[model samples]
Target: MTADSSLLAQAREWHVLLHSGRATAADRAAASAWRCTSPAHEQAAMDVERLWALLGQLGEQPASEPAAAQVRPLRRRRSLRWAVPLASAALLVLALWLPQGAWMSWNADFATAPGEIRSVELEDGSILTLNGATALDWTISEGRREIRLYRGEADFQVAKDSTRPFFVEAGPARIRVTGTRFDVDYDGQDVVLAVTQGQVQASDAQAQPLLVGASQQVRWSGERLQPLQALDARQQLAWQRGKLVFRAQPLSEVFTELERSQRQRVIFLDQSVRDLKVTGVFAHDDPQAVLRAIESNLPVRLVRLPGLLLVSRS
Candidate 1:
């Protein structure tokens, strides 16, 4: 396994141990030492801890349940060492196997690496521009042309094919358009649609026939589609022109976009600093240089570690 993946595995182990309420002082000390070895390790541990907390919230028991009149002690209690690993395995499956999109991209017909932009002509002469780290598969059948966006984002300039309707699928949401220009992004949880020209129909498992027109955007989850919101469609498509524009966006969001464009991992240590608003346009050419520009404007310090970048308050 790569060094980053190895560290993540180790961190998950620590998560199960420490959160099981069975860790000794020595074990806690060891975990601290491991985190100090690298920021990547710390970040992985943080992710596991966050997930564990969320699971606890979801598994909360009812407060009004009556106590059993006759209580029988179990012959033996199962060790959490085994139990927590099972739960962690489920979490891993959800991260890799579900709609997060990494696994699906392996079979994509067209893809673009991080920081690389490419445009291709479809069989029907439509132009598709894939953003960095994006993957998709397309098929043109007799009556319909379909594209599945597994990860990242894409801009479509559909050809005038009145006979074959075009459709783009991102997770549980679908976008249907005969001939239009628009953008779609699947960011793990939500499929975001932005229309630049003409009108398109967006639908999900729960909602159908939602219309999106020029200069409007909407977010769709599996069960619900958000109301259309007004936005500058051109500004949202700035990535296609090799630039990233942020308007009062959080530092965490900026870091996420930066990581994707640079194909590098970024670890933010201070949660309090994550929500600071940032606004600017930065080139996607060199991620390190882009970060330096951010540091100059924002009150944050970045530490470059092997295979990862650490963000902390200045």
Candidate 2:
């Protein structure tokens, strides 16, 4: 039986809250009562738990191998281990998974794991390049072609078909184009569109269609589209070439990208350090090198932990 979307959302929210360190006993009691409301609610909660279990096993080795042989050596020489509690680890996983629509990722036609960049050739001769941790679903019919980007970023080199238009639904914005090359980045809260070739029409839930041409980009958040800004489209899309170009961006923004490409969680202990300006072109393949450079140039220190990295002000 299919669970209602609203019920699934509620179940996911409750799961995250229960796992979060901030949840109180009262919250747990309330969540239990919520699950008792209906059989659908209970099933939704079970589904959420099942998904969490699957996520936990993503890093595990095959069961055919002996457990003793599965252990691996630590990458860092520093013996400093942050005493992260079991609850905190669960919370961290949920924090990283939920925002990317874990449900959608599970059902996506195409998905790339963290730190994996993949290219797919469509039946229509279009080429799709998916960035790390991205998930998307697509359908190409005789009348039209539609792509729903649930999370992360993708570059599309659409094949020319004058009789059919390509439509991409990303967060609050929808893009319609015909035989164009463009990039779309959607991180749950915001949607960014950059056109590298030809022109595309982008619109949000409440905004009119905005024409974005080559070298132009626009951002959509809270159902509103920001003004078009001109940029070096090639520079913005350097990730396809194994490079990341940052120009005076916030340290938090830089780490977000690193988290995708490195498959590691980075937590900022001090909020003030997140706003530090960072500018440089770094190789995407060497996330540790980039972190070392940031540590050297910025007034910050790094603490390596198992599956996580902590940053704080010096």
Candidate 3:
């Protein structure tokens, strides 16, 4: 491997060991030897360790970020009591995990306030429209453009950067593009990608590419991808407009939509109505309007309680 490639590989191994808690005594000694060999090596190892610490605290991260090591969340495993025991020696070995690395700055984060839409002017002068209540992190470093969506969503009007392909990550999927106008909906396990113009490819961090075209939408369920034709692209991205638009959308999808809009939380007493389809644009501010619309059309009942709303099949 080349010098840069070798360093990158070592960096990745260090990261996996630090997070997975799967590193052995031999591995640590080798890592320590590598860290002491050169300043660059030490910096790389410390950087990865620190990153894990910070991630445990906030469940968010970015490139070149200073990591906090003072706080490490306990590995949450309900079945840990049944696992093999490692005794005191294992605990003592981990005691040397000194807190190291730089603390990241707030300025490194890209956030948009609720009900406020912001546009980002990229280095290439291309515009990115950030929808309300969005938090994402991106970097253009070492001839690579990377965008990691920690939370919320973004509408990209990508400028062509063939030299450094623009990439957006949401949940388990990464979107790669040369240039395109697309909307990425990242709701944890499911990432719904819609391309209005140009083209983009969706894949896991290490998987084959799935090309998406104009007026198309696809979702990644971590293990596999399902493509759906754009029957209602507007509804797919109504959050950007402060509205939830549905056109003969399934009743289940409607409840999901209502849950997204309700300030508190909407609960459905009946799951049977979830399969029924409803069509309309419901103003987000007063979700009661949508309920009323649903009431006027479907054979259903709406029950409004303190801080919660319910949809039931009549």
Output the number of the TM-score-best candidate.
2
Cα lDDT of model 3 by residue, 1-314, tens digit: 11232453476576668557888888888777877888777666655455344334332222332356223442234125323222222322232131111011235367654334688988865677765456677788657888887655678988887888898888887788988899887644577888989888888765678888898888878646675666256677777667878877887766654544443234455668877888787665566788788889898887543223456787
lDDT for each of the candidates?
0.74, 0.80, 0.64
Cα lDDT tens digits, model 1, 1-314, are 12454565677778779878999999999999998887677776776565555546434433432356223442123334345545544553354223222454578899876667789999899999988778889999999999988878889999978899999988878789999999998766678899999999998877768999998998886547888899675567788777888889888878777756764556565567899888877776766666876788888887653234557899
lDDT of 2 by residue, 28-139 (tens): 9999999999999998788668656645654343334455644445322111232333344465566545543346568999998777899999998899999988899999
In model 1, residue pairs whose N, Cα or C atoms come closer than 3 Å (at least 3 residues apart or on different chains), thus clashing, are none
- Model 2, TM vs. native: 0.68
Candidate 3 TM-score, true structure as reference: 0.55
In candidate 3, which residue pairs get closer than 3 Å at backbone N, Cα or C atoms, i.e. clash?
Answer: 66-102, 251-276, 252-274
Greater-TM-score candidate between 1 and 2: 2
Q: Where does candidate 1 stray beyond 4 Å?
A: 1-105, 221-223
Name the lDDT of candidate 1: 0.74
Error of 2 at 143 (Å): 2.0
- TM-score on alpha carbons, each prediction: 0.65, 0.68, 0.55
Error of 3 at 19 (Å): 39
